[model samples]
Target: MMEKADICHIVMYPSPGRGHLMSLVELAQSLLRRHPSLAITVLISSPPHLLPSIIPYLSSVSSATPSIAFRHLPPSPSPSLSSAPTAFSDDPAMYFEYARLNNPNLYHDLSELLSDSQPSQKPKALVVDFFYSVAAEVAAALRLPTYYFLPAGANPLAAFLYLPTLHKLTTSSFKDLDGNVDIPGVPPIPAKHMPSRMLDRSSRIYGHFLETSTRLAESAGLISNTFEALEPRALKAISEGLCVPDGRTPPVYCIGPLVAADDHISKHECLIWLDSQPSQSVLFMSFGSMGVFSSKQLREIAHALEKSGVRFLWVVRYPPPHDEMWRNLAIKPEDDPGIDEILPSGFTERTKDRGLVLKSWAPQVAVLSHDSVGGFLSHCGWNSVMEAVFAGVPMIVWPLYAEQKLNRAYLAWDLKLVLAVAESEGGFVTTDELAERVSELMLSEKGREVRGRAAEMRNEARQALSEGGSSRVAMAKLVDSFKKGMM
Candidate 1:
């Protein structure tokens, strides 16, 4: 092993979006907190609209942790790769991926910046989100150690790592599989609970996913945003190389639940609304930053909220017109008048006393941390799930896209930390079903049982992060390995 350097730095390349950027930022901050002398840089390449929110959030964290800096790269131009899929022109799922595949600017910008760095300031390792398979190639060329940061639990990671095997074992997509697909060392997840992207073998994104998962094995290690107690079985499987052939797998580190702290949480109006509600009385609903629902669906949600009769705080966004694809766009905080037009007639006025509907972004961390929030009606994004667990709040899982369906399965069926909202006939969750689910999560005995489990998990999560705990020890070992040039 090489002698420890006087200064250690890691460059993080976050995929374009709120969730990816936020989780990576949290990981950087966590490293800085644990190792005060370390320096970090977050290389961002997101859509223009999200800059307002993301910039401020990063700024706040930077102010407190001066070792961390950010570099926002220009959004890449349209598909430049000759092999780029022409069919993905309007597919929202491929929005960022398309930008990344087409634009070569990210690699150039990163390389140039690193080349310009002083010898002492040059990063020893490059940390990148899972979407950044290209960064691994860059790191290998530069001979810098690379760690793949998976902003999800080990279960999802294990499932994804085994995609090739799953593809070989079945003739059809996992969604079309007759029964549960039993992943070694992980729970038997129903085929329908797999990610929508993985459900179709022919989709461009599916191919991309498989390639990325394979590329991940080339890295020095994996930094999972999960702890041991949370998914011991999955973590064990991953560490033992059950997800992939032994010696092909990288060293797996479980150092997570790396959720961000809301710095300006005190200023959000939702906190005031939450304060007035009694403990465990309000259900908070917020799809992730990119989550969307049709106008008709929004109306149904409003009616369901009205019928549920539970004190609620709903975070709403206006989706693009019914015919238009939902792009990665932000609804400005100042331009929320259209919500009134999109919501059902008289819904706001009727529920004024019992509900508060926040437009666009809310202090999600603060909202979940609040004593008044009992249950979360979430899109089951891993970050939101982590926050809810840390706050000891159970969830009403309503997965939207990406790995959310997989998360929903783990949370609802595997871990028993949430209640799932059943979709009605024709694949839409009706107002009646929504209302029943909200009521059950808020008022039923099952809700209490789930909440108890959530609280227990919350305690376990807190313990995992404390001194001498699993996360702390894992993170310590990771830092030591990096310093010793062993990772």
Candidate 2:
């Protein structure tokens, strides 16, 4: 073991959700593997409802990596709201408020950790998830360098850094805009295709998002979970300072494809089923943790799947209540009802020979990496997208919420790695439309071409993580800058 005095220490603060935490943890693991003398302390601030889901993952990481430590900040009281938000579970305002309320605890915990460290082990930086940009002020008062880790690709980062400019240019909400909105790196985003939070400029969530976007420029550097080969154009635009027109863009480090480690012990039935299928014949469909559908939407999907005749493994979740008040809330895994109760009657029996419909959860990373899996019908969340990319699986982009619509735009229009599924008004996909996209992705010539591209990208992703690759070089540069105190 290395001497304590020779270690370089750092603090990482990720936002509340599982996706955000997983990204930062993977990043820490990567850093520790490269520089064994480095020490990391991850500060976790989980919402009360999400704590259970987070604990098991945290325990596993601690057991596997003793060099990395975890500290749970005492929960801050919930912010007083004027009214109950539409989707309380997935609300951005809740995340922002949690981060804001925990500022004092963050300062105390960080100061204590730093003061306790040996002289040579003073923390080189305090890295935070972009959602917690408000913490930069705390880092500043303590005289620590602050960096923002965006758990997303470069295209979303470009849009986020450019959001303040877009806000200034527009007089109305993005949803009401007459034409496409232009960010520096990516193609013009249709007004309706902008992130749901940005659609209403007057909402509290929009205000919080705009503030976070403005504050991102104050960081020492921005690190994204994407590689140079994956997003060449967007990365170039960011490097050239095109995204931030009025301010200096901080140095950007592209160190990723930071996927979660696959679970090797517990093999799911889905994996067993995939083993029996022909090579590259199964299409896997799963939404991210927050993704849910209405009963009507679920039925439509079942109809499409049964009619398509493709071998498949789908993870099904209970539909949200039709009650307007509860319609947007996420369905927890424990809350999932019987599969037969939600899907079309006899849907499971009809598709039994060709498909396996699992309830609520699956080992997503393992399934995507399986040899028999060819296509992914995904919600286009960045983490899910990266996992698919790493597995070399082409996708059918079906964006649900958060920045997913924007991600869909990038994956489909800019990268051409996935086929886009168009949604009708109020975000419903028809049976015919779903079936057609499924067939196109599984059997058509276009599917073959996209599959080839995804394969090429998978190789590039592996290469980027290897020695002498772009991501590895970027990782070295980040560590060097930290060591030299070059902000």
Candidate 3:
């Protein structure tokens, strides 16, 4: 697909984990797929580690492509807040530490990349990770165009970041903060629903989150991984108010839900499983890779799911120890049991027909996109929210930790498309509460309303990803920033 073009493209993302890399890879591939003539460069945090020989596919990426190139940049020898894992206690202090430790090196790396790169061609623009505000500064230093790459829809972004601004005006905090806090231009969000870390004055992570948010306010414009119908208000606000209130706020591009189902399989089996199930009869529960839960918690969840008698698809990662029966498989088979090994006995066999317990990774998108999926039990990660919205699956927001509470609030309170489970009475949810909410959300009248709304959103979201959709236009505008200097 290569054609003669003089522009060089430098794509930079955090190297802490695969999530950023995977997202960046997809975007890069999309650009390469769409514009073969364009020169592309990707700067990862570290060199690619050797892929497991047993699983062979990444070689397809490093080996097959000629025009596109991947380069690894060095991060701080010390890991930072962004790299730190969330503890089961749901604290955000660690998050601040990660960002602080990482950003210095992150900034240093971007500056170095800009200063040192000798592209056979000069970069036409600098595309950055939205979370990493330093990219814009780096581009500005060299007078290059910059674009903010947001991984979720604008609704939640506007909802979470503007909480303080809204709180100041409305004399109330939004949902998820704990109790109902009212905000300007937004519905009530609870204190419990607000990110647990945001309330922590002593949070090492919250401070870092605040720092990055400050940088986000100054980015050139937003290039979100969502389409218009998914977040109309957010897109409008971003377009008019310059999107960001505290910073140099730029335009917004909603070219997303950038979903690619064909990327991985052995996953399709899930779809076939759904095909055999009744419509809207199944519940999908998954806490993303990084979320941590105690072994007792895992066992409680296992017992709760079993007691509910609801059909479910649960993705079990390394689990916390529950009983001697669980000790045998305390962790994921690989990666040391660290903690994941405690599960109740007869988990798979007892729930065999009624449930499917998948270890490691399953294609989340494909599963959610299925028709039989009635409700989603989620951690409220931005990516999961996008998938749930796109798939029209209503959520049961678990929000295990981190910014998840805020994300959960957006879906449950602001959008009224999902139900939020509170953790205030106690820090964590027990199995009884988990099953109760699952039952309520998956079968009750309120659940029906949420499901209907979610389905409606799914339709609107799909259209946004189509030709000439608002999201498409927004994406085009962002890409055009490269072709024409920010005018």
TM-scores of all candidate predictions against the true structure: 0.88, 0.94, 0.79
1-487: candidate 2 lDDT, tens digit per residue: 5777777888899988687888899999988888787889899887566677789989999999998999998877653421233334647777777788889999999888768636775677999988788999899888888989988888889998999988888689988887887888887888878888878998988998899888787788888889999888888998899999898999899998888777555878888899999999999999987788877888899999888889999988776655332343344444644788677889898888889998778999999999999899999999888899999999999998878888888889878889998898889999999999999999999999999999999999999999999999999988876776423
Winner on TM-score (2 vs 3) = 2
**What is the TM-score (0 to 1) of candidate 2?**
0.94
Measured by lDDT, the strongest candidate is 2
Lowest lDDT 10-mer window, candidate 1? 322-331
Minimal lDDT window, size 10, model 2: 79-88
Per-residue lDDT for 272-300 in model 3, tens only? 77788899899988888766566667888
Return the clash pairs for model 1, or none. none
How close is each model in CA RMSD to the real structure?
Answer: 4.5, 3.0, 5.0
The digit string of per-residue lDDT tens for model 1 on 202-278 reads 88778878887887776788899888999888887877788886338888888878877664545688898888989
